[model samples]
Target: MQQIKIKQYGNAQEAFAFEEQEKPVPIDSQLLIQVEGFGLNYADVMARNGLYKDAPKIPFVPGYEVVGKVIQCGKGTPPDFIGERVVAFTRFGGYAEQAVGDFRAARIIGDRISGGEACALATQYCTAYYMTDYISNLHEGETALIHACAGGVGTALSQLCRRKGVTVIGLCGSEEKVAFLEAMGVDFIINYKKNNYKKLIENRLGKRKIDYIFNTVAGNSFKEDMKLLNYGGKIYCFGGAARSGKKDHILNDLAFLLKTGFVSPLFMMMKSHGVIGVNMLRIADNHTAVIGKCLGELHQLWLQGEIKPVVGATFQASQIGEAHQLLESGKSMGKIYVYW
Candidate 1:
């Protein structure tokens, strides 16, 4: 097997290496997949930074989701599974020429969707779908405020919300992303760089505050964005890209603790709002069956053309470093890919 493994804990430019290793063989009830393509995620970047909770030790392969064909089957494995195409979320060891996973964890990809598209949706869209439908409880015609509105989960939520007739107000980091969100049918876009997002929310939406807020970036913006939630609305906290950089201030630490603790949900109570925190990895860990169901629904939505995954770009296996660089630079809007 050829895999991209992290050799050190530091920046992407310094850590990852491409090397050859023995391919994995299936265990009891496990299926070995011949890699086609895999999606790059922020969790992969966090793992490289040594920030991801419970990340495997240094010198480990990091990839969450992949789409591939089953090449070999283990003893007692179902006979129908051989030669089937599937998508799955592996805790690690997915960025390689071959990997192994369980049958229940794998969702069969139907013939209507392409392999590349299925790979893109396997993790990103599944996360968004579960959060939007199960956690946020988003209703038709409800308004949604999406942070990181041009990234992988954001783009998926944009299309899904559009399909469900939910108006989306996209908040992104740049003007180019503003244009990108516009093309994706975003009802309004706020450039968090040059403008005031709080005022943009008030000015554009009037008194009907945001019905649901999907926040991937947390920090001062997380605190500020909470004010936009309407009565009985829910805010789903999924990621914390806002505090990505190291900080040293005494008050900053206190503030972050306060915000993550009581302040957020306290405000929710004051206004009859709801605050929900989601760690998809944790959800996948504890509620495996639920996560599998969500993946199945997302695949069906893709087959029906109700949602489309945004693939920023694809690279060959040797281009692993370049793929990580693109993710670190934040130049790409959606999931980056590495193919064998």
Candidate 2:
């Protein structure tokens, strides 16, 4: 088997090494997946640069979602799973041509959904569904602010909001992303690069405030998002993309804390605002059943055409480093897929 591993902590191109490894065998409740493809996530970029705390130690494979067929199954697994086309959430090791997945975290994907869409299930769409559908219960007529609104999970949120009749204000850093969100039927698009998104959104709605905020860009963006929230509004903070992906961002880290000051429980209670953080890896570790339910729901939506995954780019497994580069560049509009 061939796999790409994070060789050293640095830039994407310099961090990966492709090598041969013995094929893995499934154990109790696990399946051996013959990897057809996988999705490139921003966390993979952070992992390559040694920034993501959840990433495994160096010289480890870094991948979350994988799409493929089950070639073998373990003792506790059902015989029906073998040869089934499925999307599996391997917390890591999806970068390999073959990987192992606990059967509980693997779901049978319908023929209606493409491999790219299957990849979206484990991380991007599942996260969006878990937050909005299962947790937030985003209702009709609500307004949402989605930062990085053209990225993988951002696109999923846009699709989910549009289907639910929730007005979405999509925020991006590039004009290209703005155009993509516009086509996705976002109520508003703001290029945060040239415009003050917080001020622009304020100007448009006047006194009206956002009901939901899906934020990954933390720091100043986090502070600003709190003020934008309306009464009963909730902000789901999943990541900190605002820190420019530099090697030594210690100074930037300090600046991030300075800009985003500490807030006591009293302030949140007084304002009637809420902030929830999500680290999907943590969820997968502690709440496997929850992830299963989320993936099942997303699969049904994809089948019904209520939601879809956008494949911004696809790279062969050998080009793993380039795939990481594209995802981190912020140029890729949707999920990036890498196939064996």
Candidate 3:
């Protein structure tokens, strides 16, 4: 079997290496999967760079979600699962021609859903569903401000919001991305680099404020984002990419604290405002069943044409480094798929 593995902790392109390995066999509780497609996630980037605290040790296969068919079943496994097409959230080892996991961990995708959509539901889309539905308590008709509106989670959120009739103000870094969001059915599009997004929303909404803010770009963006929140609005913080890769990242946090003063969470308490930090990986660890339920729900929506996966690009398993490069370049929109 051929697999992609992280050679060590460093640059992703340098760290990822393709190699041959012995085919894996399943135990009584596990199922052997013939790899079809796997979703590339930010976690995989972190795993390659050694930034993820929970990342597996070096010289390990690195993929988080996979969509494929069950080629072999373990002892005592159900006869029905044989040759069934499914998607599974494997903590590791999905970037290969074959992978293995427990049968119960896999979700069988119906014929209505394509392999690409099933792979998406296993990761990025699942994260967005859990973040909005459970962590943020987003409701229909509520206005949402989503950062990175053309990215994987952003696109998924837009689709989910469109289904629920939630008014979404999508924020992006470029004009091309703004156009992309407009095509995705977003209510408003702001290119943060060219215009002041905070001012644009303020001017249009007229102090209405965003009812919910789903943010993946924290750092300098957080301060401005918080200002756009209505008195009772909730901000779901997911990532600090905007503040990362800097020598004084901690200092930036201190500056934000000083600027906001005691009125951060204190204001949330006094005026019903809320800031909920969300890490989907953590949620998946403690609430696997909850996450699984969200995945199932999103999968059903995809089947019904209420939602869709935007696969911006697909690369072969041998081109794992190229996939990582595209992710780092920050140019691609939607989910990137790696197929064997």
Indicate whether candidate 1 or candidate 3 has the larger lDDT. 1
TM-scores vs. true structure, each candidate: 0.92, 0.96, 0.89
Off by over 4 Å in 1: 75-77, 110-112, 247-261, 264-267
lDDT of 2 by residue, 66-178 (tens): 88899999988988998998899899999999999888888998566778878987899988988888887888988999999999999999998888889999988888887
Rank all candidate structures by their lDDT, best first, as comma-separated numbers. Answer: 2, 1, 3
Off by over 4 Å in 2: 248-252
Task: For candidate 1, write residues 180-225 as lDDT tens digits.
Answer: 8888889989988889888878987776488888888777776677
Candidates in order have lDDT scores of: 0.79, 0.86, 0.78
Q: Give the candidate number with the greatest TM-score.
A: 2
Candidates in descending TM-score order: 2, 1, 3
Report the lDDT tens digits of candidate 3 across residue range 75-157.
Answer: 97777878988887777888888888656557788566656667778777887887777555566778988998898988988
Cα error of candidate 2 at position 141, Å: 1.2
- Which 10-residue span in candidate 1 carries the lowest summed lDDT? 241-250
Candidate 3 structure lDDT: 0.78
Query: Model 1, clash count?
Result: 0
